[model samples]
Target: MNKPECSRLYKVATKHVCALLLCFCLSLSGLYRVSAQDIELKNPSLETKVLSSMLPDGWKRFEQSPDVQPGACGITQSPYAGNTYIGMMASPDWSERIVQELVTPLQANKTYTVSFKLAYPPEYFSSSVCSGSFAIYGANELTEKGEILWKSPAIMHQDWKPYTAVFSTTKAYKYFITGPYMDTICHNAYRAVLLDDFSPYMREVPQIIVQARNSCKGEQTGSATVRVKAGQPPYRYRWEPGNFSDSIVKNLEKGTYKVTVTGANGAAATTFVAIGENELTADVTSSAPICHGDTNGIIKLNISGGVSPYAFSIDGGVSYQDEPLFEHLKAGNYDIEVKDGFNCILNVNNFTITEPEPMEITAANASAVSCSSVKNGSVELLVTGGVSPYIYEISGQSRGYDNVVSGLDAGDYIYRVYDQHNCYVEGETVINKEWRDCAVFMPNAFSPNGDGMNDIFRAKVHDAVTEFRMAVYGRWGQLIFESRNPNVGWDGTERGSGLPAGSYLWVVTYTDSKLQEIQQKGTLVLVR
Candidate 1:
């Protein structure tokens, strides 16, 4: 061999031997630090050091060049947490990474949380846009890649940003990596990721928890409590069936209730609670059927469970009342509702009212001879309502169902009917004897210009008159006023229009008590 070639080979061998010796020493140091450290991963903050390279002591680089820097990296800014941080180059086809094995393996079917500080320095511009992310892998041995248990979306920012990833695993995870996601960063052509203060710990995800507050037996204050546990605070709660924001809801019905609690960090959880039959109810009692023509019907309501100071509604939805007693109601059906302090409504649809058995008595005419003398009279009564076999008394004369009194002196007579149910009805009949001859008197004049008195042309009738009628005609016989009723009069108007002051002729006809027909004619004057 030539002397120059031998010298070059000797130099190459010495360089490799020194490199191997340095790697061996760093490995031993990392092992000792890991055994003595409290953190699951040795040198978790990247505090350990090795000379001749930009790598930390306990971390391994992956497939590409990555560097650790104290102040800046290619115009990038300083570290976020410690004295030194790692920087990696990312592109479409390749990305640099730093990976480590945890001292304690995460249990299967368990949750964990990881946090890290990251930034894309504004002074360092590669593609004008950069993004990076982190992930956890479930593996028995540390590898470049494995089954991913959790991952975070790629984030791009110029200033230091804090990010957290919460995830669950079905397999024990002993390895974790932080860098750019190759598939996403490649689209932007190239990106530089600055990572510092990488931290991983076993932490449970936010969970929505529900607790029950059962109401006392036969009460409606049954409630459910909603909460978020083991998650970030400042939680927001929403309930089903309504938009209630409180942590506890009262006066619940017998059903399932759901609540969603959202954490401040956008984590959410849902839980459910159930209520049973220990709620409020309304009991209504109705009175017996009120007899027709009575005003004493009643309905009373009783409520149990729930809070007090209840309100009521009976008109379907028209109004609400605080009283529970309903009185003077007609015989029919009604729907009732009761509400407690919690605004829960108990609806009763079967309230009923009915009429009592009927009982009635009617008395007919008493006889009289004249308008000013004593006379013999008769009273007849018709009995209705209640059971059959009724008894009646008239003017102190008692008899059976067909009650009749033929020998009654002139006066007022009282008649009463008693039914089988012992219910009674009373009535009065007068045998008048001082009646006068039938006649109708007409008014001579009237002033109907909005006057308070004497504004109508009306006629007065005497006693013993069966029927009377009066009609007024104009001077030209135009038939301006007509009436079949004696009490009905005319205002000095023709067809609802005021007539000129003038004299009008009237004719009155009537049937008298003696069955005689009388007719009279007269002139009535209108003042205005």
Candidate 2:
């Protein structure tokens, strides 16, 4: 027969079978047995009683064998010794009738294990006839009814066996039907299919839990849920600031907090309940000013009215357990910071540092005075009332005295004093008189010869000189001869060695014992 003829005949046959079953059920007059044993058929035969009707309401008949036969209702092949068999196929595309009326209605928001007895004729087993799936629909008709509740492959053994599938219902549904979509190698040829005792199972929901936040306070205060599976999505959470809607509570003062959490399924759970109090307090004290050179100075900072383990910080860095002693601070203002167990920081407290006053020199002067007119004389400098052990200097051109007057100088001259602070008083004097007869005398000319006549040139001092330096230079100012002690005055021999006769200029300077300058300049001739 052509497809249209075959389809028309199959429809007629399905209507007849459905009408017979309906009439038989109606005639029973509600006298059907409800006993579990009566309902449970022991090894029901598929070939004999399993009737093939049109797919349940709202389901479209998908595939079936062209040759229909009567058969016992067994999960697999025919169970009876001799019987005829008929098979029916259905698809879920039609308003989800299979899942809505059959599978979903049985689940009711529960987990389930569903099982069915199904079989396919050997001829249907091929690469093209391999696998198929079934779905349980929900009320929304738009959404997949229940879950994709179950599925099976078209390739089944000739001997039927029970195949099972399991799924959990996340939402409730009013009706459900099982959809069986099959692939067949017999393109134009139809194949037989069978099903029996489709059953569903259910299980309880899992538990929910709450985990407390390990720490809390001020800006750094908050708690978190704990003891949860690593990737489990949290269904609900609440903190002290609010109820079930809020996941995190902020702006917390010092206090204990409570938290509660619920699982997705709304089962098994936990909560953290406690009074959170803002008991934190703090205190600060100003530090004393430190001198510039003082490396160790105590800055008094006392923290009170709070928890222990107070932390200290000079700036906004990591807090330290103990307060630090500041050292080597430049001349300026500084900010000191202190914090408690919580990460609360005190604003910058101003501390001033003053530089030590430069070392002071109170007084310095000559100790005594002497009246003298010569290059050599003695005078004691009484440099008292100054900032300790002053340093003294006599003028370089001052004759008859030491260049540096540490303890004292003997002269009729001046003294410059420097105190420990490196501050100094310009040249000062107690005696203002010239050293008597201290003039430096040198012959205007001389002759260099073997004779005992005026063959050498020298200088003479009338009084005893203390420290003296003299030098003779050619007209161009290049030094020819020099000397320090007056007793070791120059002999005009061109640095104590013989030289060609020439005219030369001489200069002499010395400080007397009284710290007076004895300076002289003249010209001399050496005739060789």
Candidate 3:
């Protein structure tokens, strides 16, 4: 072997290396071309419609059942981004779904980001229960079930909101489907959602460089430098508090600074830097324990002269949170500590959560009866201890505050009382069969003044009266008032004139549940 032979071998190897390099560059070019291709979607806005049957141009149905098929219905609100949007009914039975094919199959083992706008239309039908959630799925083709890529939290507003999800697949995907989760049933009329502007694109992860200079001794400001390493150039800089457009920002205060660099192609990178901070302090305000509930109380912290992105710990440096408020704490003392972005820590100790006075409540049912005639009975509650004006709620009956619950059929009932602080107490009562006799009682005297109590001369009926009649007369027996209903009462007035305070005669007749008929005569005194 000689030097000339060695030179020839080196040249051959160099040629092969150069050829491989060219192929690699060509492959990179092809990747960019593929990404430039739009995700061919038919009727992306779901604008195609036929009568009450709204069928988007390119979407497929989950089922062939005419009664359960997906279609467009007129919506009062305008679409979020286009003229038409797709909707689905979520129910206990098979949920209605809208499906469509993707123009290009998703590459196997590749990651893609998907985004769409969804809304819960405010208009509702009979039996519509407010349900605002649905799921997105991916599969090779349309089928009864596919891979669940995303299930969103319930959407509750009529205004449209954007939702996004990212997924990586081992197999190529050719279809996109939307519907309720497999286990969720849609018996409520509110179980519907509007979807528009669906999109899928390959997401690019970015690589960037960021450097910062700390302030020297006696210096009050620092500087930061950012440079792009692998992304497209002509980058835009968004520096916190400064909003500077250049890559270099100087004269920043002694704290923390963050900058986001976005490339012309929509790729972005974020970096954070801290300057100087000697010490940080945290102050806290503790809330006392609630009166009678499982969630105990709350504590909030106020941080002054510290770096951004604060972390808090209820215990002594055991755990931390980004939020400054701590809730659902038991009645006891606590030690709170907070740390800033610069690792500077501040601790607040000896905080106590006091317990509020207990609430007392009692419930009773008047004229108790069996389930067949329980409406005749009334439930009365007496509550003490707790802030006022208190609001009351029954487990299945009352929605507002009431001392008496009437016209209820026989059933076991539970009630809750809420005060100004939203603290609550719960109690239970029941109505059962125990028919009681109904009787009429006449008051000996009455006052017609505007005071809330004893303001009318009326006969009181107890237990359950079927029929009642009452008559009032002057001293000479001149009929001054008459009423057929038992609850109707008379004020101290004749023909719209205020009568002088005096004694009057009253006669009453009533039919009780236990008696056929009865009559009673009594003398009444009226006073201002």
Best by TM-score: 1
Tens-digit lDDT track of model 1 for 1-528: 522343245345446644664476456654432211112454556654432234565576553556665432344466676667776666666556766656556556544556677776433323344555545455665454667666666666767788776666687666656565556334656656677776633344456568876554455667888765456567788888767788889876566777877655545566777776535687788775445556667889888976677888888858888899988777778998887776656889968877656776644656553433223356767766765677878756786667666555567878877766556778888865545543456779999988689988887654345567788999889888889876589988877789999899999888765678888898988997
Worst 10 residues of 1 by lDDT: 30-39
lDDT of 2 by residue, 1-528 (tens): 433344466568677765664465445534433221111111222232444434322223322322323322222345223353333333222111232222224334444444565555433212122332334334544343334554555535655567765445566654444444433343433333545444322222223344333233344453444344321244466565455355545444444555555444333234554434324443433333233244444445556533456566665555454753555455456677655554545545566655444333244344321224432233344444335555655654332223233323354455555555444455454433444544557778887686878765666655445567878898788888888865464455664578777788988887664577888888887887
Ranking by TM-score: 1, 3, 2
TM-score of each: 0.42, 0.34, 0.35
Instruction: Judge candidate 2 against the unseen true structure and give its global Cα lDDT, from 0 to 1.
Output: 0.46
After superposition on all C-alphas, the RMSD of every candidate to the true structure, in Å, is 13.8, 15.3, 30.7
lDDT of 3 by residue, 327-420 (tens): 9987777888887765556778888877766677764544465233225566777777667777767774445767776655566878777777
Model 2 off-target regions past 4 Å? 1-11, 14-48, 51-130, 140-171, 181-200, 204-477, 480-528
Model 1, position 109: C-alpha lDDT score: 56
Model 1, CA-based lDDT: 0.65
Prediction-by-prediction clash tally:
10, 79, 13
Model 3 stretches astray by more than 4 angstroms = 1-40, 49-54, 62-83, 105-116, 122-127, 144-151, 159-174, 180-190, 199-235, 245-258, 261-528
Worst-scoring 10-residue span by lDDT in model 2: 34-43
